[model samples]
Target: MNTKNEGVISEIERYAIKDGPGIRTVVFLKGCPLKCRWCANPETQKSIYQLMYWPNRCIACKQCILECPNNALSWGNPGIQICRADCASCGACTQICNSQALTMAGQHKTADEIMQIILKDLPYYQTSGGGVTFSGGEAASQGEFLCKLAKECKKHRISTCIETCGYAKWEIFCELLPYIDYFFYDLKIIDEKDHMTYTGVSNKLILDNFSRLIQAKADVTVRIPVIPGINNTQKNVEQTIRFLLEQAPGCPVSLLPYHRLGASKYDKLDMEYTLAELAPPSEKEMFQLKEQFVSFGFPVRIGE
Candidate 1:
């Protein structure tokens, strides 16, 4: 039944408990508005197809060198290297790599195609109070496709949720609210200057959208990533608490401590890991930070 509403996604993780209530399947969509230094899923940030090279899996085979249409791949001093400027990401090299050393990150899928997959876990979702969660690079960025997929989920009586940066237009959210039951909204940086400095985006749109979503009474949870030497500051946390109180009084908050879980991903993508040395907060610190929000009469936890 492949309803052919094409969309690009990085991966689909099933039986994910952290995405939402009970057991859930998370569809990791591609592309995002924010460029946070400590991004856990850097591969999802790009809209186009990109390559992830796992050097450990390389068998020293030069098959990719022969398959490359642009001759973009060549043997470097250490190993095979891809010329950033010449590589077209046509997946020729990826296809020829029998060892699965190189693979494309984004996969093109249709809503109907995805629905068939979602149906496979319907029993687990129904029994465990869980369903499909549309996570992103910011799901609202692909509003039309999101709406279509969400509609399909709802039509099947499947619970749908979204994890967004809250940086898109109000119309997009409005279009999705009817179908999406839960929203895992991220509130990374509170201060305008700090937000722009770290994520390369203003906090205004995000704040306004949060306010709108709260006012609309949509099922939204504020998820904060406590990055060390960044937004975890006492002042910023207090400011964030204040903002939350104003926009979404008593809303549930989840504090996700920054970790190096995605550090290796940067190297695979041929990018630098800026926060390589930044460590996650200790249990005590995480709880102390959680108390900041809890004190404001909001139900808060250390992790989502």
Candidate 2:
């Protein structure tokens, strides 16, 4: 109930195997510093709560429109239309919708409240050598809240991991280093200009933090999402290999092939996806890239 210790989160995925070493629970924190064009989890980009309306689930009930105090809901061509600008995400309509066509995407929960959910999977973590993974829009965006949760996990002797973009201040990573057992850090674009062009942020900080992490000997796996016509070229891949060879030699790499799996999420959130037409790279391309990195003596894998 203490707002000061609370953080906004998109959702939590239990029994996740890819996030960390073992069977892990991934806590998806809300908010991000980057706006990558191919971001799959569009719902987690914003820092606040959002409404997700699934028209197919609507039963033509006008109760949502009637209960909406802000007049944000209105009957439209197919079902209920939400005026996002005027909607406050109050959850009033969601509470009254019996069909469950509408739902909120984020939740405000204190670190202790989240720890309760995490502890439920303690048995799995213990048996499988997995623990909890603090994933995000970028977990470092919620530094204080993340540190608090990590602290609690440590108290319970639960191994912890963090999946991050390495965009936040170095101080935040320092705070998490003591508690985090592993890290899944993203290195989207090696070039600063291209990084800013695609993700709306410079890669200087990301690179700097990554170097620092390597120097500090943090257990990290650098992940690269191979987007076609973007960072999938030989030049970018060479640059990435060179950088990793210099900064994180012999580090493990995970190549995440681009996919349109989350394209429908944009429609549900009523947002535009700039890369809707972009196609995922072929398996051959991913394997080639992996081989390239592997040739450099860096351990590489195809998927996350």
Candidate 3:
């Protein structure tokens, strides 16, 4: 846990309550092994700094085009042309542009530096029984940095929580258990074939890692995103519940009803939204699914 160790981060969000119990500051780490189509923070998937363009915000301002040192940007009809291959993400254009038509994602920070920023909200955490949550694009992928930073929090007696995709090497996940107090584990699908089709990776490792967590008796809470056209069906819900009961009986589950809140992020990153027209599950559907999990004797929470 060296203070000098640094990591690529997307954002340090403050006063987030839903990440864990009480008030929390969520540190969003960059990079992921899975490419879930419904990912809200598409910006966090890549560790590298990226330029984001918003066409609507462009007032045909040639500032970005003229200021780009590498000639990577050009004026296109009403939108800005971005030669991503040539662009360096140096923020030169973002600095000169006034409308915020362009943005950048990812920032580099050391464990010591980040804690200084997080410590500003220490009073809120202390009074509200809140602490810090390390989330991702899969915090496990950045094992060395995550562990070091979490240990620093431990040194200060601050509770630590992690939101993970459970897709990393078991060794990495195992080593992190000691530093993390609570885990928000995502279990998107039980079937390997469907899982790969949707998330661009197999769920075998995720399931295996979760099994170990249960066996280890770690404080884990399972989160399942209720994607309307994907895993929200009755068949998938029952299958998921059966698997959870078998591995960790009476384990708490939280059903995160899908929302289009991150849809704009995809637009910002110039990526296609696969679930573009698909709607989130209705309140009735979410409750019915909750009841189904409860019927199997597993404690359930909705949209938490």
Which regions of candidate 3 deviate over 4 angstroms?
1-4
Per-residue lDDT of 100 in model 2: 90
Per-residue lDDT, model 1, residue 81, is 91
Output the worst ten-in-a-row residue range by lDDT, candidate 3: 1-10
Model 3 Cα lDDT, one tens digit per residue, 1-304: 2333899999999999999988999999999999999999899898899899888787885888889999998876558878888999999999998999888898899988999988998888899999999998888788889988888998888889999999998887787788889989999988899999999999999999999998988999999999986898667887898898899889999999999998988867768898889888899999998999999898999998
- TM-score, every prediction: 0.97, 0.97, 0.96
> How many clashes does each candidate structure show, in the order listed?
0, 0, 0
Per-residue alpha-carbon lDDT of model 2 for 138-206, expressed as tens digits? 998999899989989999999999999999999999878899989889999898999999999999999
- Whole-model alpha-carbon lDDT for candidate 2: 0.92
How many collisions between residues are there in candidate 3? 0
Can you give the lDDT of residue 119 in candidate 2?
97
Better of 2 and 3 by TM-score: 2
Judged by lDDT relative to the true structure, which candidate is superior, 2 or 3? 2
In model 2, state the lDDT of residue 126: 95
RMSD of 1: 2.0
TM-score of structure candidate 3:
0.96
Model 1 error, position 149 (Å): 0.5
